[model samples]
Structure formats: C-alpha cells, structure tokens
Target chain A: MPLNADQAHYLFSVMRLAVGARVALFNGRDGEWTAEVVEAAKKAGSLRCLGQAAPQLNPPDLWLIFAPIKKERTDFIVEKAAELGCAKILPVQTEFTNASRIRQDRLQAHALEAAEQCLGTYVPEVSDLQALQALLKGWDPARRILWGDESLVGPAQTLAGLTPGPWAILVGPEGGFSEAERAQLRGLDYVTPVSLGPRILRADTAACAAITLWQSALGDWM
Target chain B: MPLNADQAHYLFSVMRLAVGARVALFNGRDGEWTAEVVEAAKKAGSLRCLGQAAPQLNPPDLWLIFAPIKKERTDFIVEKAAELGCAKILPVQTEFTNASRIRQDRLQAHALEAAEQCLGTYVPEVSDLQALQALLKGWDPARRILWGDESLVGPAQTLAGLTPGPWAILVGPEGGFSEAERAQLRGLDYVTPVSLGPRILRADTAACAAITLWQSALGDWM
Candidate 1:
C-alpha cells in the first residue's frame, strides 16, 4: 500500500526507514501485518504487506463521554481514552463546559496517534461535540454510565459488582455539572454516580482515572 | 503563614485573589486550614491561618519508581503519581533510560503543584534521581515491588492475595529494561513481576495504569 504524504514523511524523514526495512502495519480491520518498504522517498513511500503479525484485537464496547476542557487537555483525554482501551470517545457540551467548540478531526487524529504509540490494533472513534441534554434524551438504558460526580462528598465508591456489559464513563466539566444537570443525572436509572477518590481531580485527570476504574472493574482489564 | 513569592504571584496575579480572600492551606502535618489573606501582592503576600477545615488525609504507603522519559512526559508522570495518591515518587536511572539528568527540585515543585490542584493534603516527596542498581541494593525486604515488566506478554494479572503492607510500583524506561535488569528483578524475592495489560503502553501511560491497577487491587481504592 502507498503511504500518505504525512506517513511517508514520518517514515522517510522522521524514522529514516530505507527500502526493504520492515514496519508493523495495521488497518483496524485486518490484523497487524509486517510490511517491507518497497519504495522510499522524502515525500512519498510504499510498502508491500509481508504477513499477519497478530490478530485484530478490539477493546470492550466501552465509551468515554466527557465535557471538553482546554484544547491540550481535551487532546489528552482523547489520547488517554484510546490508550486505556475505550471503543469510542464522545465530547458533550455541558452547562458549565468552558470550551465552546471542539475539532472532531483533530481529536480523532489524536486517538489514531495514541493507538499507534500504544501498539494497539484498534483506534477509538471520536464523535463530534453534542449537547448533554440531547445526548441524555437519546440515552440507551442498556448501557450503564459511570458518572464521575465531582460534588460527591463522601468516601469513594467502588465499581465492584457492576455488571460486565456495554459501559460508558462520564467525566464532568472543570466547573462540574450544573445543579439542574446533576439533578437530571441523579434521576436517571442507568447512571451510577461514582467518585474517583477523596481528593478532587481536574477534568482531564478525572477522565483518565474514571476510565482506569471502569476498565479494571467491568471492562477487559481483568 | 507567609506565602512564598511564587504562591503570592499565583494567588494575586494568576488567580486574582485579593487581600482578605480566603484560601485553603495544608502543611501535610496539620489538617487543611482556611486562611485569610492579610496581605496580597503580585510578588509578596501573607495569610493568617484561621481554623482547620479537614483532617490530614494520607494515602496508602505506595511508592512509584519510574525511569524518566521525555521532559514533558516525565513531568506528567510526576504529576499523575502525586494526584493518584502515591506516598513517594522516585526517579530511577535504568540501563535503557533515555534521559540523562532530572531536575529534582523542578519535579518536586511539580508534585507540590499537583497536590494543590488535586486538593491533596499530603504532597508526595519527589526524590532525586538515583541509579536502579543502588535502589535495589538498599531494597527493603518487607516492601514488595510490583515490577511492570513489558516483556511479560499475557493477560493482565491480579494483584490480589499480595500482602497489603508497604509496596511500590516500578515502571521501566521507554526502551524497556535490559535483559540483565529483568533477570535481576525476577531473581529478587521481594519483586512481583506483573503486566499492565496485553498492549504495549508508553512509559508514562504504563506508570499511570500500573498505579491505578495497584490501587484498585490492593491499595486504598478498595
């Protein structure tokens, strides 16, 4: 397969791979394969697939829906979500969300980059920004949402005994969910309010921690 | 207590906290206290401790020893380690470590900032970078080290059934441990070789993941 201009530049200029050098390649659909550099140039490159190195492995059907924070932190959330084996990443605009808009393509690119760096066969799909109310309106009851509630004032709760199935983790904004939003979430049967720990965590850190907790409790980490 | 110049700038300049403003303070010895800013300036400030707000809370006895990676990522490791409730953070220079030197003061400051941001009462002490061999030479027999060996290719192992006393998580360098280093770790009776997961994680990610797994399994998170 012919490498894209960016990939070609990364291979030839950044990695300095010459022709005949083997590289691990994965398309998310096909298993990871060993590819040999057949043609290499500064701005263009091509490789021939040698053989499958490993089977295409997918993470659990877990989704991460977080309110976008700062640009760099939003990228961090996406990148960490991918690395922690989230199947999908969704950005939602909450009542207290600081960021007005998010670049979906940029976040998707970050997920792809994380997958490559973490040596994973699958990249989580990053969805466009959506309103929290609208998302709740179409909520699927079958999928449990582990709500990382910031206002939770008590000892931390464990994710043990949670059913192992389709699950999602919801990380609130920096300012946390508005009163009305909290009430709404509290009223939902599918939402399980959880605390990361005793201390308060930033939006980005909470997102990463929530994923870690969920993956360990109900996801594939066990 | 008199605020340092950096703290004064952070309060008066960055946070725009004026004189007479209330700020929470903790010295890791005393409980968290609500202090009033008696004097506030961009470069100079002071606050009188009013009263205790909460008791001093300490995390479980957990140490994180990791080989430093890139500059930013190394900072990230320290910050995350502090936020995740590590009792101590130690940077170890391994055979495959890429970075040459680590600014101990800078990393300690990062831990302080993380503790302040995360509302942690206790700040994890960031030790000066030391050689891995030297660290192992003085290893405490009672404290078990959860060796995050990248070479262990398999499903994630549970940290259950392990003694719940003083413990540490050891994350190797980006290039991973040398064969001799792995052998040395494996030969040690106090070391428990463990895998983060099936996928290969970056050094920083592995540190965070290993901590999360350890905390969930045997630390205070349970």
Candidate 2:
C-alpha cells in the first residue's frame, strides 16, 4: 500500500509528518492498514503496508442529501458528514436556492481530509448537483429517507419513532424546501417526516442534528 | 412593534416589503406579534402592533460559552444560537485561541434578524470574551457545566443521563482545549465531560449537536 499524491501532500506539507513515519490507511472497501513511508517527496510519496491495524467500520448506510448553500457552508456540510460517518453526500437544487457552482474535486478532497481527521475507514462519495425532481424519480422504497422537515409543526415526529432501515437525511437549503418540495416529500410513503426540535435550525445545523438523532437512536449506541 | 433598523433595511430594501404590509414578530418573551407599517420609511419606519397572535415560548436555561473564531463564523454562531433559543451566549478565550475582533453591534443585529426569521421571542445575550479560568472562578455548584470534551475516550455520553439544571456548553476553539485546561475541567465536580460521538467534530458542529442533544433530553417536546 502507498499513500496517494493528495494524501502525501496532506501528511507532509499540511501536517509535516516525515520519512519513516507510520500512517493509517484504508481503501474504503478494505480493512484498516498501517503504512510506513519509504520515500518522501513534496507532491508525491510512497509507503509500504506493514499490517492491518483495525477492522473496517461500516457506516449506517445513511445518505445526507442536502441543498448546498455558500461555498464555505457546503464544504462544512461535506466535511462534517464524512466525520459523522455518513455513507453518501448529495448536493441537490431546489427552488429559491442561491445556486453555486460545485467544484466536485475540491469537495471530494474535503471529504478525504475529514475522513483522515476522524480516523474513519470509509469516505462517503459526494454527488454532483442534481435537480430535486430528478432525484425523486429514481427513489428506492427500501431506503427510508428521514426528512428534517422543519415545518412538521410539532415535536411529535422524531427519529426515536422511525423504523430502522437503509436511510437518508434530506435537508433543504437556507430558504428551506419549497411548497412543491414539501408536497412531494409528504406524498412519499417511505419518507419519514421528522422535526429536529421546536426551534428552527439552519439547514446545516438541521442536517447534523438529524444525523446525531439517527445515530443516537438506531445506529451504534448499544 | 415594527422590525428593527437592520430588519427594516432587509425587509424594505432586500425583501421589498411595501407599506401597509404585515409582518410577524416574536421576541421569545412576548407571543408572536402581528405588526403593520404605520408609515413608509426604511431607515425611519413606523409600525403599529395589531395584537399578539401566539403566546410567548420559553427556551431552556442553557448557556453557550465558546472561543471566538473567524468573524463570519462568530457571527454565524451568534445568529444560529439565537435562533436555536439558547438563553445566553458567552465568548471564552483558551490557551490556543487567536485574537478575534468582535463587531458587537453587527452581531446583536444578526441575532435580532435571526430571531425575527425564526419567529422566536426570546433572544440570547452574547457576552464579551474573557479568560475561561476567570469565568469559572465563581462557578455555582448548583448549576452544572457540560464540556463537549473531544478527548473523552469512551462510550458516547448521552445528555439524558446527565443532570437537569442550569447548564452551559463549553466548546473550545479550532486548536482545542489545552492539557492544563482539560485538567481544570476534569477536576471540577460540576464539570461533566460529554461526547458528541466518537468522531472529532469541529467546534461549531459540536455546539449545535450538544444543544440538540440537551433539548431532546430535557427541553420541551411532545
């Protein structure tokens, strides 16, 4: 096993790790691997795998499909979601959204950085900007999406009441999900509409809270 | 009760709300108020409170004490915390914190706008930055302070299992709390070390998640 060019730059330039240093590596599919640097270069480096250090920790098959806000907030969402062990990160577009040009490569790099920071084995894939309608067209019933529907009007809806299954958390943009989007969500039988709480959370906050609730409720808290 | 000066500007200039139009207002103290423009003026507008529509809603007696980061994030935290209904906000300086200039007036305006947006009556007060040790010197044993201690290596602590009293959430800066700070935190009987999860969350994410957890456990819910 060897460190990728991007990983090498982060380890060397960003973190300043030197030659003959040990670093944990995981290919998302394989279990954790401990690798030591055999060669160090500014842009690229090489490492040799010593042994498997830890088993791969699978995410909860949770997808975080949120409408990206500004550049920084969008980056924050991806990084936080990756650290929180989300299996997939999706950027969707809805009405009233302040459209942003998605730099998919940079965002993917952020996901990698967050995974490295949290010592997670898996890096959730970030999807391109897709229209909300196009996303609903190919929805699978088995993957229950827990909607952070702020307008659900009460605190009765919570992750504690939802049945565990393959899941996704859909959060709207800053302006929030439109009336049409709400209608579409309400019509979906498999969409479990839940409120984060009585207060109105910003879109980013709502996503994190929803994930925490699900993780606390159905994920690995036993 | 009309919108504040900043609110008036946003409403009239940005939102283009015309004269005689109605807008909703809440202070988290009084109930939601329905107010109408008595005169057309952006900088100097007049409005008459028609009546109280919804009764006032109270937030939990919790405080948020965090080290200031960049200007925008500091503003974001103030805005979000106000909307999330924290009773008070305090800025603390830890060993590794960078010097951050505060625009108190602008932040106070942001909090007001966030409150108006969320229709919350109670707005949290933002405090000036002070040394963490000085703030805790006169700590009340009756009121517990929970630290979102990232270094806590154990099972994910639940806020539900913690005490229900006047509480504050301690979030260090990006550099994290120093060893001496950690020792002080651990030494206090009133200090409860809690984990957002096994993940290393950014300070902002930790604050939101910590508040959400506390709200879910002890605050108002169905």
Candidate 3:
C-alpha cells in the first residue's frame, strides 16, 4: 500500500525507517498487519503487507457522551476515552455547554493518535457536535446511560449490581446540566444517576472517572 | 486576614470582587470559613472572617506516588490527584523515568487550584521529587502500595478483595519501570500489582485510571 506524504515523512525522516523496515498498521476495522517498507523517500513511500500481526480487538459496546468544554479539555476527553477503551465518543451541546462548535476532524485525529500511542487495535469514532436534547430523543433505551450526577456527590454508589451490556456514560459541561435538562434525563428510565465520591470533579476529571468506574464494574475491565 | 498580592489581584482584577464580597477560605487544616472583603486593591487586600461555612472534609489517608514524566503531564497528574481526593502527592524518580526534576511549588499550586475548583476543603501536598528506591527504603509496610504493573495489563484484576486503610497508588513513567525496579517492587509484601486494563495506557491516563479504581473500590468512595 502507498503511504501518504505525512506518513512517509514520519517513517522516513522522523522515525528514520529505511526500506525493508517492518511496521504495524491498522485500519480501525482490519486486524493489525505487519507491512514491510518497499520504497522509502522524503515525501513518499510504499509498503508490502507481510501478514496479519494481531486480530482486531474492539472495545465493548461502550460510548462516552459528554458536553464539550474548552478545546484542550475536549481533546483530552477524546484521548482519554480512546485510551480507556471507549468504543465511540459523542460530543453533545448541552444547555450549559460553553463550546458551541467543535473541530470534529481534530478530535478524530486525536482519537487515532491515542489509539496508536496506547497500542490499541481499534480507534473509537468521534462524532460531530450535536444537541443533547436531540440525541436523547433518538436514543436507544436498550443502551443504558450512566449519568454523572453532581448532586449525588458523596460516598461512591457502587455499580456492582449493574449488568454488563451496551452502555454509555454522560458527563455534563463545566457549568453542569440545566434544571430542565436534568429533569428530562431523570425522567428517562434508561438513565441512572451515579455519584463519583465526595469531591466535585471537573468535567474532564468526571468523564475519566466515570468511564473507569463503568469499565471496572460492568465493561471490558471486568 | 491579609491577602497576598496575587490573591488581591485575583479578587480585584480577575474576579472583580469589592468590599463586602464574601469568599470561602480554607487553611487545609481549619474548616472552611466565610470571609467578607474589608479592603480590595490591585496589589493588596484584606478580609474579615464572617463565620465557619463548612467543616473541613479531609480526604482519606491515600497517597499517589508516580514517576514524573513531561512538565504538562506531571502538572496534570497533580491536578487530577488533588481533584480525585488523594491526601498526598509524591513524585518519584524511577530507573526509566525521563524528567530529572519537578517544580514542587508549581505542582503544589496546581493542587491548590484543583482543590479550589473542585470545592475540596483540603489540598493534597505535593512532595519534592525523590528517588523511588530511597522512598521505598523508608517506606512503611503498614501502608500498602497498589502498583500499576504493565506486565499484568490484560484483565481488570478486581480490587474488591482488598481492604482499605492507609494505602498508596504507584504509577510508573512512560518507559515504565526498569526490570530491576519491577523485581524489587514485586518482592515487597506490601506491594500489590494490579492491571489497569487490556490496553496500554499513557502515563497520565494510567495515573487517573488507577486512582479512580482504587478510590471506587477501597478508598473513600466506598
């Protein structure tokens, strides 16, 4: 397969890979494959597939739905989510969300980089920013939502009893969910409000913690 | 009480607080107290104690001992550790650790800011960077250490069987612990090697996830 200019530069100049050097590659769908460099140049390169290195290992049917915050923090959420084995990432515009728009391509790139850095075979998809209300209206009730409820910040509410299945964790913006939005979520049977201990966590911290909790309790971590 | 110049600038210039503006204060020892601004200026300020607002809520006796990585990531570990309710933060220089030094004061400030942002009553102390071997030499066996062992990174070894008390979580640097260091740690009776998950996590992500797992299972979250 022919490599892109950026990939060629990375392999030839940055990584100092020469022709015949072997590298692992993944397409987020195909299992990992080892490809040997057939041609190497400053701005162009080609590789021949050696064989499958490892089978594709997709994360559990888990998703992270969070209200976007600042650019750096939003990137952080996507990166950590990918590293922590989130299958999909959705950036939602909550009533109190500060960022009205997000660079979806940038976030998707972050997810890809995070997966590569973490030696992950699968890269989670980063969805474009969407309205939280609209997303919830079309949500599948079969996939439960673990809501990080700020009001319930106290001793940890163990997720031990929860069954393992399709699930998503919802974290609000820095300003938190508005009353109307909270009411709407609380009224939904698919949502389960959970506490993340006594301290009030920031949006990013809460997202990471909530994902860790869910994974260790009911997701792949178990 | 007299406010420092930085605090004054923050209150008067950044926050735009004037006389009679009330703010919550904590000494990391005393309970949270409400103070009314008596004088406010660009470089100086004063306040009068109104009353105690909330009792001091100290986190459980849990410590985070991590090998320092890059500057921003080191800062991140401190901030997340504070927000996650760690009682103390210790930066250890491991055999394969990259950063030779860390600014203790700056990291302490990050912890303080994180505590304030999270509405935490106490700020975790950021200790000066020390050699891992040295710290382990004088280590108290009574306080167990939860080691994020990269070798065991397959399944989530549930922490449910462990008991909580004075405990610490230790995360290695990006290069991970040298084989000698790993051997020494594994030999220690108080060290319990546990896996984070099926994927390799970056240093920052591992720190946050390990803290979350320990907190949710054996720390105050219980």
Candidate 4:
C-alpha cells in the first residue's frame, strides 16, 4: 500500500525506518497486518503486506455524545474516547454549549492519532457538530443514553443492574444542560440519569469518567 | 481575611468583583464560607466572613502517585487528581521517567484552581517530585497501592472484593515501568497490580481511569 506524505515522514524521518523494516498497519476495516517497508523516502513510501498480525478488535457498540467545549478540551474528549474504546463520537451543540461549531476534520485526526497511540486496530468515527434536539428526535430507543446529571451529584449511581446493549454516554457542556434539556432528558425512557461523584467534574473529565464507568459496568472493560 | 495580590487580581480584574460582592471561600481547613468583599483593590483585597456556606468535605483517604510525563500532561494529572477527589498528588521519578523535575508550586496552583473549579472545599496537596524507589521504601503496608499494570492490559480487572481503607493509585510513565520496577511492585505485599482496560492508555488517561475505578469501587463514589 502507498503511504501518505505525513506517514512517510513519520516512518522515514521520525521513526527512522528503512526498507525491509516491518510496520503494523490497520485500516479500520482490516485486522492489523505486518507490512514491510518496500520504498522509503522523505515524502513518499510504499509497504508490502506480509501477514495479519492480529484480528480486528473493535470497541463495543458504545457512543460518546458530548457538548463541545474549548478547542483543546474538545480535542481531549475525542482523543480519550478513542483511547477508551468508544465506537463513535458525536459532538452535540446543546442550549448551554458555548461553541457553535467544531472542526470535525481536526477531531477526527485526533481520534486517529489516539488510536495509533493506543495501538488500536480500529478508529472511532468523529461526527460533525449537530444540534442535540435534532439528534434526540431521531434517537434510537434501542441504544440507551447514560446522561451525566449534575443534579444527582453525590455518590455515584452505578450502572449496576442496568443491562448493557447499544449504549451512549451523554456529557453536558461547561455551563451544564439547560433546565428544559434536563427535563426533556428525564422524560425520555431511554435516557438514564447518572452521577459521576460528589465533586462537579469538568466536561472533559466527566466524559472520560463516564466512559470508564460504562465500560467497567456494561461494556467491554469487563 | 486578606487576599493576596494574585487573588486580588483574580477577583477585581478577572472576575470583576467589587466591594460588597459575596464570594465563597475555603482554606482547606475550615468549611466553605460566604464572604463579602469589604475592601477591594488592584493589588490587595479584604473580605468579611458572613457565614459558613457548607461543611468541609474532605475526599476519602486516597493518593494519586504518578511518574511525571510532559509538562502540560503533568499539570493535567494534578488538576484532574484534585477534581477527582484525591487527597494527595505525588510525582515520582521512575527508571523510564523522562522528566527529571516538576514545578511543585505550579502543580499546587493547578490543584487549587481545580478545587475552585469543582467547588471542592478541600484541595489536594501536590508534593515535590521524588524517586519512586525512595517512596516504595517508605511505603505503608496498611495503605494498599493499586498499580496500573500495563502487562495485564486486556480488560479491566475490577476492584471488587478488595476492601477499602487508606489506598493509593500508582500510574507509570509513558514508557511504562521498568522490568525491575514491575518485579519489585509485584513482590510488594502492599501493592495490588490492576489493569485499566484493553488498550495501552497514555499515562495521563491511565491515571484518571485508575482513580475512577478506585472511586467507583471503594471510595466515596460508592
């Protein structure tokens, strides 16, 4: 397979790889494969696949839906979601969301980088910023949403006794979910309100913590 | 009580607080208090305590000891530790730890800011960087240490069945613990090796995840 300029530079200059060096490769769909460097150059390179190293290990059917915050922190959410084995990442613009738009390409790149960093065989897809209301309108009831409710802040209400199938963890913005949004979420049958802990975690920390809790209770972490 | 120059700037310049404005205050000892700004200035300020807002709620006796990574990430670890209800933050120098030193004052400031952000009444203390071996040598057998063992990376080994007492979570550096360090930790009676999840988590992510797991299982979050 042909390597991109950035990949070529990373392999040749950064990693100091040359011809005949074996590199692990994954394409989201295919399992990890051992590829030999056929041609290595400053800005271009090619690799020949030797054999599959490991089977593809996709994350459980879990999505991370969060209201985007600052640029760096939003990037952090996406990166951590990928590292924590999230299946998909959706950045929603809630009533209290400060950022109206997000650079989807940048966040997607962050997910890819996080996957690479964690030696993940698959990279979770990062969706563009969308309205939380619209997403809720078309929400799949089969997929349960674990809403991080600030009002329930105290002891963590564990995911115990809650059976997991298709699930997503919803984290609010820095300003927190509006009253109307909270009411709507509470009224929904599919949305389960959960508390992180006694302290009010920042949006980024809440996202990661929620993911950890879900994974440990109902997802693949078990 | 008198506010320092930085606190004065934070109140008058950043927060735009004026005389007669009520502000919540905590000294990590006394409970949170409602204070009115009796005297406000550019470089100096004073407040008169009106009443106590909330009782001092200290986190469970939990410590987060980690090998410092990059500068920004180290700051992140301290901030999250404070937000996550860690009683103390300790930076340790391991065999593979790249950073030899850490700014104790800056990290302490980060912890304080995190406490403020989280509305925490108590701020976790950030200790100066020290050698991991020295820390282990003086380790208390009563306080069990949950080690983030990378070798057991696939699936999180739950903290269930482990009784809670004084406990600490130890996260390794990016390069992971040296073989000698791992052997030493494995042989220690007080150390309990645990896995975060399937993927190779970055040091910062591992620290937060480990703390979450501990909190959910045995800490106040339960």
Candidate 5:
C-alpha cells in the first residue's frame, strides 16, 4: 500500500508511528486492510499489506449535489462528503452561486485528507462545477436527487421512511435555491423534495445532516 | 425579544425584513412564540410577543458536551446545537484538547445567531469550560450522557431507537477520546455509548450526527 508524503509525516512525526507499527489502509476501492511499516522515515514510509481487516462496505449509491459556496466552505463540504461516505460529489453552479468556479484538484485533495483523517475506506469523486441546468438535464433516473430544500411548505419527511436505492442530496448555495432552479428541480421526476427538519440548516450542515439521515435510513446503519 | 446587531443588519439589509414583520423568538426557557418587530433599527431590533405559535418543545433536555476545538469549528458546533434543539452546550477540557480555552461569550453569541438564522424560538446556552471530571462529578441521574463516541466495540446503535428524555452528548476533541476518558465513560451508569456509524466522524460531525440521530429517534420527529 502506498501513502503520500503528507500521510507519512502525519503517521511518523505527528502521530509518532514507528517501523513495524500496524496501520490501516483503504483505497476507496478496497476494503479496510491492515499494514505494517517496513521502512519508516520522517518524510517517507513504506507499508506492506498484511491482510484485509474488514470487508469493503460500499456507501449507498448516493451522490451529494450542492452549489459551491466560498472556497473554504466548498473545501469543507468536499472533505465532509468523503468522511460521510458520499459515493460522488457534484458542485453545481446556481444563479446565486458566490463562487464562479472551483479547483477540482484541490477539492479532491481535501476529500482524500478527510478520508485519511477519519480512517474512511472511501473517497467520493469530486466532479468539476456544472451549471444547474446542465446537471438536471443529465441526471440519471436510476440515481435520483433527494433535494435538501427549505422552501417546502409542509412537515419534513424522515430519511428513515425513504426506500433505499440510488440516491443523491441537493443543497443550494448560501442564498438558497432560486425560484427558477427550485421550479426546475420540482419539475424533475428524479428529484425528491425533502426537508431536513423545521430549522433552516446551512449548506454545510445540510450536507452532513442529509448524509446521516440517509445512512440511518438506507445506508449500513439500518 | 432582542435581535443582535448582525441579525438586525441581516433583517434590514439582506432579507429586507421591514417593520411590523411577524417573527418568532425563544430563549430556551420560554417556549416558541410569535412576535412582531416593534422596532426595526439597522443595528438592533426589538419585538413584541404575540403569543406562543408552537408550545415549548423542550429539547429532550439534552446537553451537548464537547471538547473545545478551533474558534470557527467550535462556533459551528454551538450554532448547530441550537438549531438541532440542544438545551445546553458545555465545553469540556480533555487530554488532547489543543485549544487554549473556550470563549463562552462568543459561543453564546453564535448560539443566538443560529437561533435567529433558523427562525428557531429557543437558543441553546453555551456553558463555560469545565474539566471532564468536574462535569462527571455533577452528573445528575435525571440527565443521562449520550456519548457520541466512535470506539464502541459492538454493533452500532441508532438514536432513532432511543427513547428521548434528559440526555447529554459527549463529543471528543479532534484527537478523539483519551484512553482514560473512554474507560471512565464506559464505566459510568449515566453514559450511553452510541455510534454514528462505522465511519470515524470528526468531533463536529459527531455532534450534529448525534443530535440528528436523537431527534429522529425521539424528539419532535416522533
């Protein structure tokens, strides 16, 4: 198993990991595995795979579609998506999107970092920014969008009640879902309008809340 | 009811909430009630209580106990706790707690801001920093501690499965629960060890996850 230099520094120096120390490794594709350091250096380290520690637990085929916010907040969402086991992350640009574009590579790095920090076995794919219309036009019916919307005018539904399948969560930008975008989403057959609860959760909070709700309802938790 | 400067600015500038707008306010102790903006000032605003719109839905009497992290992350926890319907937020000092000290005033402000943003009637109180032992010493039988711990060595449990009552969620620092702290928690009768899931969530993530789980299991969602 290979670990980047950042991981090496974290394990060797900050965490004081030594040669022969057992470590866990997951490539998002493989299940959690145990590895022992064969060569440990401050800046570099090598680990030989020992055995599979746990069978791969695939995240529910859920994608998180959100309007990219500020740079740091967007980065935060990406990291959290990886930690929470979103299968994919699509940064959508809405009318109120504060950010013009996103650095996909940097976001991907954040996802990797979040995965490493949480000892997660998965890293959700971070896609390039797409216009809301473009994403909606291309959304696959097999994978539906559980829109994390706030303007719904009724009692919120629990994720527990939703049937498990290919699902994704949609969270708007700080300004919230525009009328046109909301109308577009409401018109889509693949989009399920769901509110997290009575309170208005921020985009980041909504993202995490939706993931947990989905996990509790359909993912491994149930 | 009083709206802080930032909230006033938001109401006047951002949302353009005009005078006499019907709003609601809750101070945790009082139930949620409708109110009208009696005075709309750019820097501050006052409201006149109309009546209780929604009778006090006391937060299962849960206390959110978490280690002090960075200012922003800590603030995030406080804000989310208020919106998640936590009654109180206690900043705990643990072995791996890296932050200098908890900013009670700033944190309290965050809670209030969160309440205003979510249109929530109640605000969760931000408590001063207390050592873990000090907190345990004062543990009341009436209030159980729902430890949002990640190291539980068994099948994961859901908050949706729990019966709501007086409870506190203990979120460890970024480094995680100290070995000694875990041992102490496991030995406590009032401590209920619940897992968010198999994934290792950050302290902030764990806080929100636990609250969501608790609400789904036993709060107003019931």
Candidate 6:
C-alpha cells in the first residue's frame, strides 16, 4: 500500500526505516503481512507486500461501552480496551459524564496505537459519542451487557454461567449511573449487573478491570 | 493520627476540608474510621478519630513483583497494583530493567492514594527495589508465583484448579526478561508461568491484566 504523509513520517523519521527494510502490516480484515519498503522518503513512501505472515485472529465479539471522563483518562480507556481485546469501543454520554464530547478520531488513533504496541492484529473501531438512553433504546438483546454496578458492593459476581457469544461491558462515569439509569438498566433483560470487586475503582480502572474480568471469564483469555 | 506536611496540604489545600468535617481514614492495620478535623492548616493538620466505621476488609494475600520500567509507568503499576487488591508491591531490578533506581517513598505514596481513591481499607506495602536474584533466593516455595511469560503464546493458561493462598504475580520489564532470566524463572518450581492473553501487553498493562486474572480466578474478587 502507498504510505500517507503521516505513515511516511512515522516510518522514515520516527522508526528510521530505509528502503529495503521489512515491516509488518495488518488492516483488521486482512491477515498480518510482511511488507518491504520499496521507496522511502520523509514526505512520501511505499511498501510492497511480500506475503502473509499470520492469519487474521480476532478477539471474541466483545464491545466496551463507557462514559467519557477526562481526555487523558478516556484515551487510556480506549488504549487499554484495544489491548485487552475489545472488538468495538463506544463512548456513552451519561447523566454524570464529565466530558461533553470526545474526539472520536483521536480515540481511534489511540486504539490503533495500542493495537500496534500490543502486537494485536485487529484494531477496534471507536464510535462517536452517543447518549446512554438512546443506545439502550436500540440495544441488541443477543448481545449481553455486563454492567459493572458500583451499588452492589462485594466480591465480583461470577460471570461463569452465561454462555459466551456477543458481549459488551458497560462502565459508568465517576459519579456513577443515575438512579433512573440504574433502574432502566436493571429492568433490561439483556443487562447483567456484576460487581468488579469490593473496592470502588476509578472510571478508567473500572474499564480495564471489567475487560480483564470478562476476558478471563468467557472471552479469548480463557 | 497527626497529619504530615504533605498529608496536611492534601487535606486542607487539595481537598479543602474544613474543621469539624468528617473524613474516612485507614492505616492498613486498623479498620476504616471516621475522623473529625480538629485543626486544619495548609502546612499542618490534626484529626480526632471516632469509632471504627468499617471492619478491615483485606484482599487476598497476593503480591505483585515487577521489574522497574519508566518512572511514570512504574508509578502506574504501583497504583493499579494497589487498586487490584495486591497485598504487597515489590519492584525488582532485572538484568534488562530500564530504571536503575526507584523512589520507593513516592511509589508507596501512589499506592496509598490509589487505596484511598478505591475506598480500600488496607494499603498495599510497596517494597524497595530488590535484585531479582536475591528475591528468588529468599522466595517462599509455598506461595505460588504467577509469571506473566511473554514467551508462552495464546490464551492464558487457567488458574482455575489452583488453590487460593499466598500468591504473587511477576511481570517482566518492557524489554522483557533476558534469556538467563527466562531460564531461571522457568526453572523455579514455585513459578506457574501464565499468558495474559494472545497479544503482548506492555509492562504496566500486563501487571494490571495479571492482577485482574488472578483476582477473577482465585483472589477476593471471586
């Protein structure tokens, strides 16, 4: 594939890759491939695909839906979500959500960077921010939503029994879900309220813990 | 207990707590208690402790032993370790570890902050940086060590059947363990090497993932 200006800069300026250097590439759908630098320059560059290096191996159909907190911490959530094998990232607008909006493109970049750093073949797509109520209205019942309910304090309720298929983990904002939102979530048949642990984790930490718990219980980590 | 200068600054300046304000307090050994601010100042403060509010709720006896990396990332590891219910945090100097020294005091402070933020009654002790060789020499055989082995590929090997007791999770440096270190870890009988997941996790992320997996499988989170 012909490299863009940013890609060229990353390769030539940052990575210091010269002509004839080999690099690995993956585009989520296509398997990882070996690409040789055919023409390398600071402004423009191109790579010729050599061959497939690895078959496409995606994480389980898992999604991470979380309310955006601070910019850096939101970025951390996206990065860790990608590393922890989240197939999709959704930023939700909750009643107590601190951030009014999120830079979806920047979050996507963060996910891409995380995937690259973690040696992940697939990069999870980061969706634009959506209202929590609106998201719940269009929710798919087939996909189970694991709610990290802070109100139910104790050891994490085991997610063992639920058969793994399509799943999502919903983490609330720092202020937690409103009573109405909590009631709506509890009323939903698809929602399975689970505790992370006895301690009340920060928003970013809760996201990571939820992902790790889900992965360990029924996702690819098992 | 009388507050130190830093603690006083945190309480009076950062938190903006007024005299007579009730604040939660814990000292690792003692149960959580409600304290009334008797004297408040920017440089010094005092609190009068009331009766215990909550009994001591300690996490399972789990230790996190990790090779020191960059300063900020090292601090992150300590914070996450405390939040994830690590009873002790041990920074070890491996052959390939990037950081030569660590501010044990600062890291301990980070752990304390994390514990306070998470509403944890117990704070995990952060040990001074120790040589990996010396640490291994005094290793307790009875306490199992979960080695986050990067060499072992694929999904995490389950800790399902393993009985919960005193345990430790060891995470290597960003550069990863040297060949000799890898051989030594593999040779240890108490070490149960496990993969966090299929993808390679960064040192900080690996520590969090390892802790989450351990907690889900055997720790108090279960």
Candidate achieving the largest DockQ: 3
Alpha carbon lDDT at B169, candidate 2? 81
RMSD of candidates 1 onward, in order: 2.0, 3.3, 1.3, 1.4, 4.5, 1.7
Best by lDDT: 4
DockQ of all predictions against the true structure, Cα-based: 0.55, 0.43, 0.90, 0.85, 0.46, 0.74
Interface RMSD of each: 1.8, 2.5, 0.7, 0.7, 2.2, 1.1
Record all residue pairs in model 1 with backbone atoms less than 3 Å apart, i.e. clashing.
none
Native contacts retained per candidate? 0.41, 0.40, 0.90, 0.78, 0.50, 0.68
lDDT of 6 by residue, A16-123 (tens): 999999999999888799999999988898999999998887988999999999887888899899988999999999999977788999999899899888777899
What's the lDDT for residue A13 in model 6? 97
Error of 3 at A13 (Å): 3.3
Candidate 3 local lDDT, residue B204? 93
TM-score of each: 0.94, 0.86, 0.97, 0.97, 0.82, 0.95
What is the TM-score of chain A, computed separately for every candidate?
0.94, 0.89, 0.96, 0.95, 0.85, 0.95
- The better-scoring model by TM-score among 4 and 6 is 4
Q: lDDT scores for all predictions?
A: 0.88, 0.79, 0.92, 0.93, 0.80, 0.90
Greater lDDT among 2 and 6 belongs to 6
User: How much is A187 displaced in model 3, in angstroms?
Assistant: 0.2
Which run of 10 residues does model 5 chain A get worst, by summed lDDT? A152-161
* lDDT tens digits by residue: candidate 6, B1-222: 789999899899999999999999888887799999999999998999988999998888999999988787888889888888899999999999877788999999899889888888888899999999999999889998999999886888888888788999999998799999999899989999898878888988999998988888898887
lDDT of 2 at A175: 75
Residue-level lDDT of model 1, residues A1-222, one tens digit each, is: 888899999999999999999999998878799999999998898999999999987889999999998887888889999988899999999999977789999999999999888778899999999999999999889998999998874446778778889988999988899999999999999999987776777888788788877776677777
- Model 2 pairs whose backbones collide: B27-B121, B27-B122, B28-B120, B28-B121, B28-B122, B29-B121
State candidate 6's DockQ: 0.74
lDDT (C-alpha) at residue A135 in model 4: 97
How far does residue A143 in candidate 5 sit from its true spot (Å)? 1.5
lDDT of 4 by residue, A1-222 (tens): 899999999999999999999999999988799999999999999999999998898999999999999888998999999998899999999999988889999999999999888889889999999999999999989999999998888999978789769999999999799999999999999999999999999999999899999999988889
Q: Candidates 3 and 6: which is better by TM-score?
A: 3
